[model samples]
Target: MTNLAKRIIEFVQRPGYMPMKPKTLAKKLGITKKKLAKFEAALEEAKLSGEIRFSEGGRIQPKAARGSHLGIVHRIKSGDAFIILREPKPVGLTDDIFVDRNDLKDAQNGDEVFVKLLQRRRSRGQRCGYVVEVVERATNVFVGTYLEEDESGWVQIDGKDYPDPIWVGDPGAKGVQEGDKVVIEMLRFPTVGQNGEGVLTKVLGSRGEPGVDTQMIIHEFGIPDEFPDDVLNEARLEAENFNENDLTDREDLSEMTVVTIDPKTARDFDDAISLKKIEKGHWLLGVHIADVSHFVQPGTQLDREAETRGTSVYLPTKVIPMLPEIISNGLASLQEGRTRFTMSAFIEFSAEGIPIETRFSRSAIKVTQRFAYEEVMPIIKAKPSEPIEGVSDEIRELLKNMHELAMLLRKRRFAKGSLELDMPEVRLSLDTDGKVTGAFEAEHDESHEIIEEFMLAANIAVAVRLNDEGIGFLRRAHADPAEAKLKAFSEFVTILGFELEKYQSKKHLQALLRSVRGTPQEQAVNYAMLRSLKQAEYSPMEVGHYALAEDQYCHFTSPIRRYPDLHIHRLVSSLVCDNVTYRGASAEDLIRLGHHCSTTERRAERAERELTKIKLLTYFEERVGEKITAVITGVERFGFFCRGVEIPAEGLVHISNIPASESYEFDRQAMALVGRRTGDMIRLGDKVIVEIASVDVDRRELNFKLLTHTASKPPAKKGAAKKSPSRGKKGSKKPNSKQSKPRKKKPSTRKKKSAQKRRKKR
Candidate 1:
């Protein structure tokens, strides 16, 4: 055979081929045998890398179960790495391991990795191991600062072990300069210390720009920037009617005095309440919640998305709604003068704080007025304005009576060990352009407390029915306090000459709150106590809310924003539709539901906190070098954190900022940053002056310089005559007016020793 034909014959001899025939080569490439011969040698000379060589038949194979372990990476901190896994363990047959640096493959912090565990070790009584594989990347979106080196630019992702520097090589690559806040899309993973190429997905304006920080936060968290078009269309279509056919089956309460009390800017009035006297010693209170469940059926496109989101995310500048705005702020909102579908709970109570009776129903209610918390607070305080067009005299009277009943209920709740947690929220004041101009603490007054009490009562009533009927329902449940934290908190308070009341029950916690009510450290102690309690979550358990001291607590109101509330509404409505009583829900379902809600809640909180931190950094940038009085809220070995009293900004005082002459250390048990040399300390409530030194908006960090308040030195003692000193010579000069005598340098040690010997001879 000729050289070309011989090459073709060799290609056909490969193991992947069944025949060594030249005709088979021509058929595979759809070319003549003569054409295939030209490139035959190159095709037969293919090569594979060491890692790729482990595949089968030139195709990569997934690791088998017997030897493989898979888990989602939570984080890769300095000391060790951690991943949350479901079951399998490689460190041992049963022990789930925590991976170390060498074992970790090219895994980003939050990626899903197939780790080969090296060994399991106990550190502080915890199981940890060394990871060996990074099977996949979780997200391509990276929050980072564009960095410049030599003549090229890249993005340094603000995450752990992210050795890959995303290279900016494209035309728009030079748009974002060094130290600029930007988002980078990871195109490919580069080897350690090499530049990984990326496209600049977004350039959040220059750092420290107001509103840019919050916008960056929204992008960094992977939160939706805009609503999907399809969801908006569905919301519009679903909102087309308020037909009589729908209202026929619902109770009509349009004649009642139903008004919503919320913050002035509230667009979604999901809940409203009304009150009336049933008898000389009895009263009827109605809590009406917008029946969002009726319109958005379960398993529908809108419902599915809402379930995935779980709840609406409220940020300082914008809202990430659970549903489209059309429904959340329109149809589902109980707007005044518009009749809307509602889930009503009629709770009757006696003078002695006992519920005489309760009834739940679907209703058609027309809200008479929308009263802001600020507006109704005065009326509740018995200071009423002239009845306006919407608010009649009778409605004003009804509000007054409701406030009284609510006060009784509130007192009773506190008696039952309802925590008086001092949770003061920071309200951001923004300009028309959505820039955070300033931040102020919001106070909780009677009007706020009154609305809270009735809502709590309504939620409890719904929970009672669901529990009694034994149906699958969503209930917000809180677990008991962690014993260790409680013990620590108790020990902390004892140092201040106080003792925590025996927490035999929620009632005991109530007593503790009451005892600390008028003290200076009340709010601090309250915050600590609140932190000790478990977060309330959606569950199937019949157990009551321990913190609220209520056994019938359920999230039945606010269906417009909360998914669990919608689920509860559906369960109750389903029970009514099926002509059945309540049915107890499965514990397993409850656990699963609770887990989702808890996780989502934490995510929302973290996102909110991140946004706040960013905004705070921006807020501080404008006020750098300005002085502000603050309270030390937290302390660490690296720094002490303090929050401004007037502004909502909090910043850290790095250890370097502390004067070298003074000694400082963090006191863990006392929760104080104490100065050992001066015996001056900063604790949870200690007041101190701090100057805003610098801000890193991208990192959402603020640095403060502590201004030492040194006590004024006593006036210099009298009869201390200043002496003359030598000028360009070793010996001292005599004092004379014309001589321009220099002041004596405070005697050097050698001069002092000679002078002392002369004085002794004298």
Candidate 2:
């Protein structure tokens, strides 16, 4: 064996060595740039010789013995866990093993562990196993609420992973008060028998204060909200050095009639569009994207920070920008009437919206107009003769052409089996105090479609160009859904009175979606289909985007906010401009980068959703006992879950709240609950009135009581009931026991009975 292979094996066999990816292993070994290639070669040779193995996540580890597997633990609230196998599975084993809570040992959520299969199959046909060893811990720090007792303090970690609070010993430690949000560093994890121990590292603030919840979310998700001094200084330097007139080696489209369309609350505009009708029923379209690569050079602090952020996070109250505001909002922002550097895609299209030719250029542009989505449709629908004030003829004609072409492209896209799962975003209206005053679903209209189609076109064009040139770049990939999942979705929709003829066909899925449009079942059906499909993520593989029906697709616009786009801009600029050099990334490097970016993106999304839920829960605290109409989104044996039509807040209606006169049984096949005595049914998509029972903000739980009379048939009348205790044996008459006794009740008993009757009536 080579000396390098020997060194790798020695390092991996160390007592406390954990599995690591090739890049991380190289860094640990202090491999120089000159030896990277030789090191990688030796590592591959080691794997080939059975001295090492690669996990499913591409982490290097020593080959495992039979019956033992390396995997990551995913624990649910019930304490039961599933081990996602990282190594090759043994014969007849499933992809994951189910470990009972008692068999989990010391394994926690997200921990890498070694499992020993029990050689037993679960009732559901899954393999069962037990965790034997924890190989690595995902994290040791956590955010939680600090609770103060008489002389001791405890930290209740957020989420369901740590069900019980960890003991922190002293209440005065870190000056933490009762109910203060704080960060905890775990000294030991909790087990079934003993409480976990931790130390208070930092105190965030008291609960329910302004901006405190946001901070909690930020810390909980480990999101980077603040820029480092070096990063900020680099951004400032770039801003100071930027000169709009320095258009060396760049195409000047400053005179073009380009316009930007975005939300009215938008602070930075990264994309602008222009279109012109050409001879012989052809068209020239220009998609100008802010040239973020021009300022964020490779191996610079700004580039490092942007790459680490991956994408800008859009919280309801604030934004954690990928790049500092100086560059993201100032230098790279394509503001109206301002000259900006951009990477432009010029495409020539036939009248049928088929691309005839495509080219890229580093260019300079001056945006002629900026229109919010709410404003564009009004102008487009206006009569040409009745031109509104400040609406120039050139800008009006450009918008008209844009809408025309976008429709053609959109129609063609759907015809090719693209799925349209564009659910309306529930936008909250907040006051200056960051409290939600109200919320409404944002409309997705033609104005939004115009920009979407253009951006998609540019992305596909760039991806194809890069692929044709044999370059490695990240693609926005969405894998096809598993057949089993699609079949389940088919059964689900069929139970809702919708038919999906062929579950495996995309066209059939599209048809199913179309049939439910504009109906009360639209939201439920869309959400189910979304859950059925895999999430779209960044990868260098040619997996293709399933939803867009595009085989070659990448994110190329909005470089100012998305790192992948900036990377694409750099590659494309190198091809078009003579002054730039392409710093090629290997396929392995792209894969790692893609995984990191995808993780960061998911983290951002989860943080936003979590914070939004907190805000919504806070809003609903003032709304307890209020009645609102809701649609049942999920049904179970324990009752159904529903979301309010107006507020969009979800809460559970426990089966215990059902009328006592009738018993309800869960119908799993039908996705509903049925009252055995009254024959009333409650199923998905059923609209019903519900009253908010309570709100628990700390736990992030909401409860509702189903108004039985409004949701189903009223309880049978007391005297008219078919089944009663007064009925005796066949043909034998018996006096009613209650009437014969004639017993008097206490005043409190009478009032309690009266209250129960009133509750049943509602």
Candidate 3:
């Protein structure tokens, strides 16, 4: 075989290789126009010799011996799709196989399908395949807006997944008006050449109405909002059965100065804290978490419901509690001056913040005070000589001690190589009608850090104890990232002009992060690093957390919100109070439960993010053409994405929108777009002023037009006399263009003449 044929075979055999057309394949292989004929001749020869094959769409592929593999389809808006394999992937095969839109057949997004791998290869060595059969449908229910055109009813799905309107024979079937937000049950999913058919199942409300967006999201994501009657009844029974005086099998620590510090808007207080200086200058810290297991017993209706929900979903305008509010916000809440049952972790730490001993106990405690995060810092900062009026000396002293220990612990945590990538939280200010008024970055001050440190201590202590007892509990695990990913991140930072000696070394990564601290490249570098790392998830496996730098870690802090914590609480309750080892869920059961909880957690996060974008898009609809300062977060071939520094809304700035005489080419290595003539670079982390071009609320897309570009570092000049386009004036025309003379608009006339000719020919 020739060298070109050998290269083709080798590329096709490589993992993740997708099928591509001849032109695309040549471009990917860097075959210039002069060498295109030879490349095509070699490809044809290879195809004729049975070394490779061509798909029906004329994309080249390798001949696969296997028939089909079960996978889940994820279709993109461009009609192309990738299949995530369910079966054990072949040694040389990728976990996902790319499918061309023509080969996708009738497969929809998220459908489980059987895919037959093609014998061809595409760019980046990605493997390509085609869907053979769809095994299962992900969902038939969809949220959309009702529409009526010439008395024909339709439901326009509110996402890119289904761009076309579904034919819903009669819009008024479910009392849905023309512009009402409704849920449709798909009778027939749409194909490329056909429209979909569905029936109106539910009328949420009129489109753009208050609370309709939230309802749409809830139905769209299939998030359970309403509790079952039995679960609510169980919660009510638990509330009625509760008695504060009955402290059976529980240690009474009501006299201790325990306090709950949370956000001002917090309603469900799950954890409380108490600290005192003890003998030998050791500090005894008590971390009291509401014993939700005490109210939500195992195998009961409440437990079943909570287990299914996995965790509470905190939306911008709503909170979907795992357990009913009767339990989560009432009996389980550690309200100030109220006696609450809790599973407590007591840790004795030296003055230097080294934990010496850890103990667990089932206890009852009355919170001395409920301090908001804003209140704690002020009390901690108050001088002893000048105490704040109406504040007790005991509360003030306790706050001071908590702050000191927490800071010491935080310092030690960083010293031990814990990754600190905490970005300020973007909170939206919503009106009573659920429309976004404004947004602000919530402060993550010392007060928040104090609570965070105590929670980490408690969680680590519990994990250590459980592991020592040989218990099989769901652990919060974060595996180390792949070496390739780290290397990629290292190269990315290097392009941004940061030195990271060893990408694999946690210490080096930490140092690099510290060097970029408070710099212009901080957010970009941090975001890149976060993307390189694996997501933290609940698992029974003993994979340690990479970011926390902990060998043992689990969720044991917020039992009121998290189901895993409740399970951990039960195990601790049995070990501490019953004096018996609780053989929790079996390994298999724990694995399944962990997977479910992790999935629910991700779903909640995605729903929240999507809703926030929707609200932000709605707010920006009125501000179209308004210029705002933004930082480029991502760069791609077509455009770069930027987020407003002040508003935190992200939008895409297409390359076409750049006021340049010459087109821009993507520089993959530099992760930027370079002007062909001007050498101006629009790279990641570059600051740019952009005008809001348009907002597509239905599709949840925000588009921006670049008004100006400021590179983080000045680009090298391609020519001494050439001026960069970055210096162009607002609404500037293309360079050297005849701007004074108005150009004739003859394209539409020509198009009409051509159309008339085509019609006459037909």
Candidate 4:
């Protein structure tokens, strides 16, 4: 069920809150017209089910709230599961409530199950919970591989776990063969001795097929892979009629020579730059973004589809675009030599890149040139005797000047306490056949920096203007770090030989990052700094960006790829163009839209990251048995995670695989593992030799075995207890073992003393 529908159901069953009208509830819950169908369906379902009643004046009232935890079930291969609770959870409950194997009942992954919270057993030292009832089955469709075993057809659900093969009971096994990846609708869930019975519905493809991994991710994430016919028809008609009225009365900048600099593989040119020299030590800069709102009018079929997708999903093998290709890649894209409608931010700046005055306008512009970052980097850096082919020195000089101003702007931002994080982005190269050829880190240079500074300037300027007008809209907000987390992080950096107070300030943290830029510890320090900051999200509130140190910030570029940028474009057009006004979203509507867009952004990021990891793991499948020296980036009681400087992956060396000489104890505060007898220690910033043991693509983990040389015989295998997997300090690994007992934290002396003192004072 949709999140909005679930919320409506919960509200209907909530006590103390009176029944509300459908229209009133939609407005109060911040639901848009696009989602009214879902809201109404949920209301009808609840009333028929007797969970709610239709009172006088057509209001929804609850009978009584159910006594269970409502959450999505995510199951593991060993049947251990975790429920990620939806909002309005029980008071004082952690977000994740664990349900063991036996407690899972017939629950599957992605089910919204109502569970009962049970007390933790003192002897077992574990918190136990079970699925009291399945409130809603998230999906009956299963994606799996069809297999033939023991003269019977079976479908092994991909990424799902069972103790034995799931037999496909002969009645539902038609039209599917062995080795095919197929989607099936389950007729019955599995029981003690019987496997889940399913009817084969649609065939995806054969196992290990090209582009199958990307498709699998799309299915798993519930990403809409294809545009509906109605949406496609609207997009086509909109593109076909773009240049009619768009060219009239808009500021005609077709005479200006604008350039679009992007990656070599980028097809959609959403933003471009135009520079004009006003006089010596002064320049007029134009950042023109494609006017997506002009084509995707609100409440249209195209708008609803785009809003549902929220953002484009870019995988290693393919891209699931937010808008139809005809729009995102055609008229809406500011391609070179094409006159396209745009929303331009004209900012006059001095030599220092400080804006003298900022203005926004609706314009028509023609991009004169498109330069890849690799080609423009040299011209910007102005290396000695670097020759430019087929380009005039005037263009080269413009790029040089742009880079100069961008540097000034970057320096200004850094001086104002902006955090420059060094996070690496890995992109996979695919051949014509869609096979993973290799993986490489994406390169960034002055070309990228220039665009970034220009975009930030425009965004900040627009946000300032909107706030001055007292306009309530979605703005990016990043609150300061929590005091408790700050204290913990302050203690962490002291091990790296810096004063705890130094790490607290953004400027000092930037300096610390600079100091470790090229050192072996750079990644570790970067990770810690990243963890110390709050995540930036969209909100209607005017909270400033803590990391950028900006009082006002919003995404104003790349409207084709992001929804908030489109909203900003609409607002800008309204304020600039006399005929238009931004009146579609209320303050409450903006708040809800902001939260939803932020969630969609994170979902897209996670999908992209997982695809990259899958591709990168495939790249290392060729070297599974190779022994490589790695830097220990994290440690735990189970094992140490060593990052491969040369390889683009981190693998864990489980504790059981360690040389059988002495037992290892984990020091939580120290973040290290110490040998009890040998006095040998494996800690962060250390090196170790490890041989790659296995790679599980479904789990997206790379496992390694320790190769420490010791003069002792290896332990025998007879009746050895199964060891739980060791994880790196980052808490990224998941093991298939039984649920672990929670460890009791060591009592702090200071806390005990403070408690005693409080009692005496009372």
RMSD, each candidate, Å?
16.0, 9.7, 14.9, 10.1
lDDT of each: 0.68, 0.84, 0.83, 0.74
Model 1, 1-762: lDDT tens digits are 345444444454343333222234456546665665454433332211111111111122233334556677665436346777643344434444576644555556666555654445566545665455554465577778777776776777753446456786643464776678788787765543444677788888666555666677676666655767777777888877545346766889988888888998887889998988877688899999998987787667788778767788888888889899888988888998888889899999998668878888888899887888888766655555544455578878877887899999988877666766766688888887666788888878888988999999988888888778766577788767777767666655443334444534566566556666655455567777878877777777666687787776788888888888988888777665664422434554455556666656666788888777666666677888999987666667777777788896778989888668777666564455556545455555556688888876654568889885332111222211121111215554322221211122324666999999999999
Candidate ranking under lDDT, highest first, comes to 2, 3, 4, 1
Q: Candidate 1 vs candidate 4: which has greater lDDT?
A: 4
Summarize candidate 2's per-residue lDDT along 1-762 as a digit string, tens digits: 899998898888677687887879999999999999899889977877887766534578776655688889999778999999862466666568999998988678998888998878888789899987776677678889888666789999977688889999977786778888998888888877888999888899987788888888888777889999999999999988999999998899999999999999999999999999999899899999999989999889999889888899999989999999999999999999999999999999999999999989899999999999999999999998996898898889899999999999899889998999858777889988788999878899999999999998999999999999878899999998877788788766665656676777778889878888876678888998999999999999999998988899999998888899988988998888543577668776688688788878888999898899899999999999999998888888898899889998788998987657778777676676766555566777778888999988878888898884344222223332123222325664322212222123335688999999999999
Write candidate 4's Cα lDDT for 1-762 as tens digits: 555556777775654464566778878788788978877776666555666654322445554346666678888656788888875567977457788868877887777666777877325454457887655565566667778867777777765354455656663354666777777777778855567777777767775678776776776567788999999999989877766345775899998988899988987889999888788688898999998988999889999888778888887777788899999999789888888899999999887777899899889998888898888876766654677676777788778878878888999999999988889887777887666776567777778899999899889988988889777778989988775666566555444333333445787677667866765556776788788788899888888999899989988998999998988888888888653555647764586578778867887888788777776676667778888777777777788888765665778889887878777777665566666655455666666678888887655678888885322111212211122111224544321111111122224656789899999999
Residues 422-475, candidate 3: write the lDDT tens digits. Answer: 565679999899999999888889999999999999999999989998889999
Backbone collision count in every prediction?
Answer: 14, 0, 16, 0
Off by over 4 Å in 3: 1-67, 86-89, 579-582, 714-762
Give Cα distance to truth, residue 388, candidate 1, Å.
8.1
Descending-TM-score candidate ranking: 2, 3, 4, 1
TM-score of 1: 0.76
Local error of candidate 3 at residue 692 (angstroms) = 1.2
Using lDDT as the yardstick, the better of models 1 and 3 is 3
- The lDDT, on a scale of 0 to 1, for candidate 1 is 0.68
